[model samples]
Target: MESPERARLDAFFRHVTEQFPAGAPVTSLIVTHLLSERPAFLRAMSATSAVAAVLPKPRSIDQHTLEAVQSLYPVHDLSRELFADSTRALDYIEETAGGQDLVLADIGGYFAPSLSTLVEKFSGRVLGVVEDTENGHQRYAALDQLRCPVISVARSPLKDCEDHLVGRSIVFSADALVRARGDILTSRNACVLGFGKVGRAIAQTLRAHDLRVTVFDKDPVRRVQAHAHGFRTAATTTEAVRDAELVLCATGNLALRQDDFAALRNGAYLASVTSSEDELELTPLQDLYQRVPVGEQLTRYEITGHYFYVLADGGAVNFVHGAAVGTYIHLVQAEILAATAALSHGRFEPGLHSMPAADRQAIARIWLGHFER
Candidate 1:
């Protein structure tokens, strides 16, 4: 925990503390995935703001992360985690706001579609939300009406840096899982669903490994873009998985469901690097398909007289080992911090907003100074 990134987060957050102060202590509900970098980030958040509660994303919490965040605030128990039952967590943390205007710094949109009642309960307004991931952004965007302004760093260029690197970490973990199964990816067929930043990186990395990579995206433009990038394009998810030995889902929107899983090649290695939605739809598989764990590497499933394997048991494979994607992730985390600064100051109206380009550039400049120096 004494690494340079801790110092870096402190400095980055200190810069934010100076650049934008709320004129009073800002009460915040932080929904975060507990990676190694999180404690430092949260500690810095506590140093600069009034924390209502610290909620961990289930499956991402580890013992070390738990120990680190334990002393910070009322870090919620994972058994009834925020994302699992957001309403209850919201109800519990509302008291901590002390009737002050509460702001949310969310990782996934845990409070989305569920915050109106709680916001109405607050004597002070629920100022706004700062969302970090595309999965969460989509959730908020889908809402026809929003309670407050939403500031998103998910589409920021700074976040794109994290997304691209996330793809590498995902491939690193998935390759390890495949090797754990006594196999390799070379000379094999791989299908990647979704051709956004992460999916594009995954396809490119797989090609570098000499895999025949095919990509499918519901957006016709992205499918064409994938084809232009020299990857084979599939017209449907079933078509994409029909012949590939390895299938990865980069879309957070449950790309592969029950019927889709029925089309996967026998013994295909399946993984997803997105949010906690089980993008490959593995829950019903337990009832419909026979599941057996293959040690710590992958879970084997039987469906349609064929077999398939899931890495990290249908969770994010990027963290199958750990969530560290080097010090670069702090850049994205810093942008999330900056979004909170906006929330504290009431910087937007009741609409969705991307991270300000000025804030994005300032964060990068600060990041370079913090790390390069």
Candidate 2:
């Protein structure tokens, strides 16, 4: 495979940065997934100049990326501490800022537990927040009171490209896991739960690998889109999982709960592309069956004589094998970089805001020009 286009990512990130000048530089508490092209994006944004602390997600962050963050922002000792304990990461925000208000560059809305808690705990100290990821957007949107301008790129068209690539990465990891079990891909029919951008992409990727894919989503419109795209659609989650040998959850909510696993196909491979707790639950397995370890990241559990294999310990399967998506990682990171810079300007009022379409268009234009050239 070709190497990740880090040079293109660096250039594109710098281009995005140039569009939005950091008006009044403010100390920021940043949370991000430290993976391919991320370090280059941060360096291009001159992230250290405005960083107070950085909390790299434990699931996605690696030693090389951690070292890069260390070198980029050598001044902050808190960054390391926060990365170690993410709960403490949110707590540090409440304690620190030294007097000046801090900007929060959040990924996945890890800091925002709820609307009331966020408004109660971090109103004045946090001047504004720049958020990415659909999960984060939902968390911030539910909040009625806003003390700071919350800028998000989760719903932007620019992010959709990255989400599609993310779905491919999810499928890549799932295929690898199943293959590791000595199973052939074509022998199993796959079903994707959740027909959003990522879910649609997952279904397509599965189909590309010669798996007859069936998809299900809570949204009827998404199901219609899936059918229109030449894929099978299920009316309900049970209908989706009952016949498929491989079931992948892309819904960013608790999709497969304790009882829901009962509807799964016999000896099915279960995996998710989003948060483990949010997408799949293992309480039924833990309570009913003895844990059987088939592999380091794979587990086998028997329910009612039906065997189910859980991948990546019920966490995001895409993240199991480094989730290498080459240059695709840069598109979202560039939008995130731009959003951070725009939030740093502090021009937006205390409310939820989206990444401007103009900015997204500008980033996409720059991205296509650089990579496609």
Candidate 3:
């Protein structure tokens, strides 16, 4: 009904006054997600005004994916740290264990080949761990590591799965990415639509760039994080993008409904960093705008007096139009896993876990060394 830009502005003022009660500078906040896949979450941070950096995960990067990332940020692979104490059965092992030794074992739904190799290196030092579930015990039995001490990250899948998923493995360095998108920070407003890990990383990254960021999440818990960061939060998706000149949809959900984009500012760019362009659902708003053919696979639509450009059939604009920089950081992950395996030898124990901090530090050092060289 209203122009996208107008709607965005309304949402911005509402959130600024309502959600951001602390009066902290917009650039000081860094919002993050404790769950979900990485890439789709991080890019959404680009929409805000104070975003400084985007820290993403290895799974979010591929060789094809890396090119877009390289053009946007300096990428590196580093092991994440651990802050939880837990047990491991087969499932538990996969959830709580780390280093190369923990990835080799599997129980029903739990497994990580990455850790098994490292187990060999650690040999007797490594103790196999898993969940306490029957399935976990069955898996540990199949691997025949009953002789070793076992642990579990959770009592069952429903309880422990979240821990397993949230437990950090490999993360990408986003200092370069933040620097690359530096121009967007310090604007009046920005929007980040996903509240997962990558989304949080993007917000933090943008903040590092001296930008302020606004966050919206489907999960209510994530929305509360806005208060902690001293940034604004939108109660709904459309509200999140209301004030944003650059709207990035990281939710990997339908990006734009007719109602969402109808009133956006002219010359504003809708960016997507999700796995697919499914986020740009245009049907709801298309009815309001008159469309004229601009080019093959490209249609021009007018809203109010402004023109909005949707890139690559709503595919990832960063990937399609921007310079290609494939995921070299994944290669580093593989190397880390391999090196940990070699160090452990062939006698590793099974378990769930996070990556070793030492291993992560090693990767960071190596990357720094290479960059310095």
Candidate 4:
């Protein structure tokens, strides 16, 4: 009997193939963190038989797992540094692709300084890029004269599902933290920075856990929405950090800086639910604190007569600590595959574009039907 995960993977692939015929010859480049949860996607893409190269995130997954997946498809594991070093990444792409067109990437590919240059150098040979993160979506907005169409999953309505998963993961991470460090979350004052979908979900979850939650967002509209939702809204980041025992940064932007760190009360715990480490601005704190390992996923710092705790080294706490999003990622992955099909078979104008609503609905319907049963 097929496993449930395999069954769902097959169903998702069938759905994509129905919309866009598979086996159409194309060359593609994929840059993403290679987690144990990614094999399903690798299998789905292999079914298309696209000539592909992968630049997995540095040290994200073990070489044994990568080797197993590579055996199933003609995938070249470009150097791990490729994702961080854009010039090297682009050079490898140029050499490996040898004129193949489609590019699919997560945060790294979207924010690479050489992206615009790659599109220009490849010219009409490139189909376009499919970006899957909020940080990438923000970076896409700043690019001037993008040469090819950009399909952004971050902008799609399907992101609500992703945010919901993030909220669930945050709760799981919070529970783990409580178990690791007792009584920190029980009726304690906590602040969540940002009122975006992820942040809103987190605030709700934290409140559900009986933590007094205060939400802070730079946008007045979001602040008003938080108030409407019956959550206290902080006027400034400083206000949110002051006296809060727990803080979560979900803004996907730099929400905390040097001064904000200075405001943290002793024994305060900070974690980033965002994809990057920019959430807490730790550069200036490097010299001020003596780092001590608390656990595999946490660090304790002695700074200025107080102890500060950071979860997952100021990165996505749930992910770094092995709290899997599990099947919630299936729908998001389906959306990505559907977007890839659309970009391969359809034409798109340059600039950021949401996944077609019809495609989004179709993907959602499949997952909803399965879960609803």
Q: Considering every candidate listed, which one attains the maximal TM-score?
A: 1
lDDT of 1 by residue, 1-373 (tens): 6767467667776776566556455778788888777887786677656877887877788778787787767887543244345466556655667577677887667777566655566556688888988788888898878878888877788877778888888888999988976888899999999898889989999998899999999999999999999999999888898999999898867788777888888889999886546376666677888788985858889766889888887888887678567767787777766777777777788889987678777878877877766
- Rank order (by lDDT, best first): 1, 2, 4, 3
Model 2, 68-120: lDDT tens per residue? 78876633342333423545654555565555556677776665553234444
Model 2: residues with Cα > 4 Å off, grouped in runs: 1-8, 74-91, 114-124
lDDT (Cα) of model 1: 0.79
* Every candidate's lDDT: 0.79, 0.74, 0.40, 0.71
lDDT winner, 1 or 3:
1
Number of the candidate with higher TM-score, 3 or 4: 4
Worst 10 residues of 1 by lDDT: 77-86
Question: Which candidate number would show the highest lDDT if scored against the true structure?
Answer: 1
User: What residue pairs are clashing in model 4?
Assistant: none
The residue ranges of model 3 lying beyond 4 angstroms of the native Cα positions read: 1-186, 282-300, 303-306, 311-313, 320-328, 331-373
Count residue pairs with overlapping backbones in model 1: 1
Candidate 3: lDDT of 356?
A: 44
lDDT of candidate 4 vs native? 0.71
In candidate 2, the residue pairs with backbone N, CA or C atoms under 3 Å apart (3 or more residues apart, or in different chains) clash, namely none
Estimated TM-score for each candidate: 0.94, 0.87, 0.39, 0.89
Rank all candidate structures by their TM-score, best first, as comma-separated numbers.
Answer: 1, 4, 2, 3
